[model samples]
Target chain A: MQPKSVAVVGAAETTRLGKIPDVSVIGLHADAALNAMKDAGLKPSDIDGVATAGISPVELAHYLGITPTYADGTSVGGCSFMLHVRHAAAAINAGLCKTVLITHGESGRSRVGAGGFGRAPSSLMGQFEMPYGVTSPPTMFTIPVLRYMKTHGVTEEDLATVAVIQREWAARNPRASFKDPITVDDVLNSPMIAWPFRMLMCCLVTDGGGALILTSAERAKDFPQKPVYILGTGESVETPMVSQMEDFNSSKAFRVSGKKAFDEAGIQHADVDHLMIYDAFAHLPLYGLEDLGFVKPGEAKDFIRERNTAIGGKLPMNTNGGGLSYMHSGMYGMYALQESVRQMRGTAAAQVEGAKISVSHGVGGMFAASGTVIFTNEK
Target chain B: MARLLPEPTPETRHFWEGCRDGELRLQRCTDCTHSYFPPRAFCPKCGSRDVEIYAASGKATLYSYVINHRPRPDMGTEPHSIAVVELAEGPRMMTNIVGCPQTPEALILDMPVQVRFDKQTDDISLPLFEPAKG
Candidate 1:
């Protein structure tokens, strides 16, 4: 599909983030979906197509009472919503669906009617990595950072610095789960979950979700909210196991997906007015910067340390505090995408002044999958 | 229940069986000559069905790892390294670094190591590694 052929007419997150122990997983999806629908000035009858990662599109349609010609249930990882937008744009261009609703909801903390992170013993991860005592995101997702740090001459202080910088952005946003500024020493002093990664370096375990509404650019003017044009989008997958990543220093999937989106958008890295690389772990943005060509390999740590990507830097990144200080609902891609949309619409809680371009990137399942979505306020 | 072992399928049964017999086996595509781990029927690179299995040198080097503070139920309270080692033959697989301190100074990246088998059950033997003998 051509860039700007489709646009995001609506975007909203669950009414209450952080801890919603009272709400079930599906209930969270519904709450976000209704809010997005209202933001778009539409109802169930106006939504002819549906997409989701939290649950099956069939189930979302059944619950939302939308009967459509197009339904997408692409679940690679947290970036599933980004892929849904990419696919929805293509589906809309092909006349498969007029308007698509992409939803993501996870009771990450509450676990109310939610599935726990358990791999079946017969599955590949259960068979290979699990038996070795590797468990949880802290154990598996963090497996590659040691080599990355060693090769780049990065100190443990560099990792903690990421959390510190993100909290600076978080302190500005009232919706952020963690608003208090933390020092690198505070981060280093936090409890250790894995070597080179303290508790502060890890993402928050909160219960929340968000949704998006997409339609043709022609119909975008009808929406109540400003349109966030889908300028470029890309998605790809690599090995499911973190151990099998092509390189210990960079994510091959992130490189592939980020390049595809940048190429499709026909924009250089310098054109990105704002950015969001999924910070599930503090080290991820380091990998993202290098792999996404925003910085050279082994230089992202210093780039971050020099405050290049921090608040008031040349590249205003993760202004919503990211998954580190912001609310992380297991799948963090949705929140990252929401922040990008907010930046483009000039409504972010910690808004970047006059921001026009934003790139949102995400990784799923210990670097197993990645997706990138480039949005622009201008058509 | 926490000693999560892989229930080998037909595609990967030989790998588990080789471990049971004190062998570290790897599959290589005869077409592309690319060696890979966690054995499969076809080459991941060239997607060729023509492949062969061979006993690796049982030699490897530490590629990457994380010293997991949270140990598995079967493992004692002490931290252990969940590591990926690059085989001398050119494939990487997940394993534990045994017979060495699971500390940053000791578990250095690129350190030479040799594979050893720990027979877990009648049907399973885990491939573990220790510092290579000089």
Candidate 2:
């Protein structure tokens, strides 16, 4: 059976996501949700269903002042919010809810004093890998980052080039955390966080929240703002154990999710006008670009150095400054979708030219989980 | 740092005991002659319940590795080599390479290595692998 067509009628985000001193976690989520309703020109009464994630969800429902017909708080690494979008579409399409709000918030910067895990990792983590000293997400991701470098002969400078490109794009974005331009030399000289991964390559911890509202395409016409249709969405997961992974060089989940998304949307990579890939680390985009089939294997380094990822290149990627320069909330996938919606409506602060067709991707858990969504102006 | 600790179960008791003794023993299915680690009762290869706990040669070849330069507060120092070693007895193990600095030139893929144990305390000794020159 064909699913009902869903449209993204609202997109709202908090201020630049470094550390917010006074705001509580629920407060941050409430602010984003309230702003989204205003952006859609809809009231809180318009939201009958909700999908939330990242540390706190039920608490947010109580603060929002409405009981949802459907509520979900499934946290699957960092891509949980993007997955929520998929689940929300089904809820809205099935008439389980007239309107759905998806939200996420994290006080990572303040709770952990920035650069801390904030809370204990999952219990399974402590039982399996923690005793050996495999602690924190950066340390986990560094395994593959190092493997990719060794397998491809990719240099630390190659990793630094991604930071440079993203920083160049971030310089133009008003909401970007780091607006100051950084050179490749600056990245190379930065302190090493992990072997082969420097401080520059890692993402900055930020406290923030993002929100998106969805309704059936038929209901979108009544809203004041232009609606961005959810053309197609897909998700995939791989082995959570980094050691048991089939391959360390690239993420299989990206390929699986991207294929399903493109197939459902009836579009190809060549047809995409813009791409918003989640960038928790600099190597993230490099692997994502390759796994998404935008470039050949072991060629993303050359792809970035050739300036194909920048503005006016073959692909305009992470125009919102990306997590590298943008905000690295606990889960960055929501921001990617938010930016795509803004770009499609010609409302982005740093809009990509003629962005009618866009692709937003979210990667989570050390190359273990990935989700992809294709959005187009037309339903 | 907390996630790396091994939690020993009934099937894994013997293997962990071997590590304490500075010996690397693998679970072998006597019926099919299959070997495995992170010890288990049923053979992952042949699903045989009948198995033997025997000492392995402790020799292996480097399958893959990464040198972590960013060590967290609990984990002191950076640039440690975490590796996947293919055992000569036909099973794979996840371990670290010690007694040498972790560098691209030092931690090459397919390099021969041998197991060594670091006694953390009286009852606990961790297994670490290092390059073994013939």
TM-score of every candidate's chain A: 0.99, 0.94
Model 1 over residues B1-134: C-alpha lDDT tens digits? 44677788888889899999999889999998999977789999999999999989999999988887878776778888999999999988899999988898899899999999998899999999999998
Q: What's the TM-score of every candidate structure?
A: 0.98, 0.90
Please state the CAPRI-style docking class of candidate 1. medium
What's the residue-level lDDT of A278 in candidate 2?
88
Best by DockQ: 1
Off by over 4 Å in 1: none
Minimum summed lDDT over a 10-residue window in model 1 chain A is located at: A115-124
Interface RMSD (C-alpha) of each candidate?
1.2, 3.6
**Strongest candidate by lDDT:** 1
Query: In candidate 2, residue A316 scores what lDDT?
Result: 86
Query: lDDT of each structure?
Result: 0.91, 0.79
* The best candidate in terms of TM-score: 1
Lowest-sum lDDT 10-residue window in model 1 chain B: B1-10
Off by over 4 Å in 2: A1-4, A112-124, B1-4, B9-14, B23-57, B77-79, B86-93
Query: Of the true interface contacts, what fraction does each candidate have?
Result: 0.83, 0.43
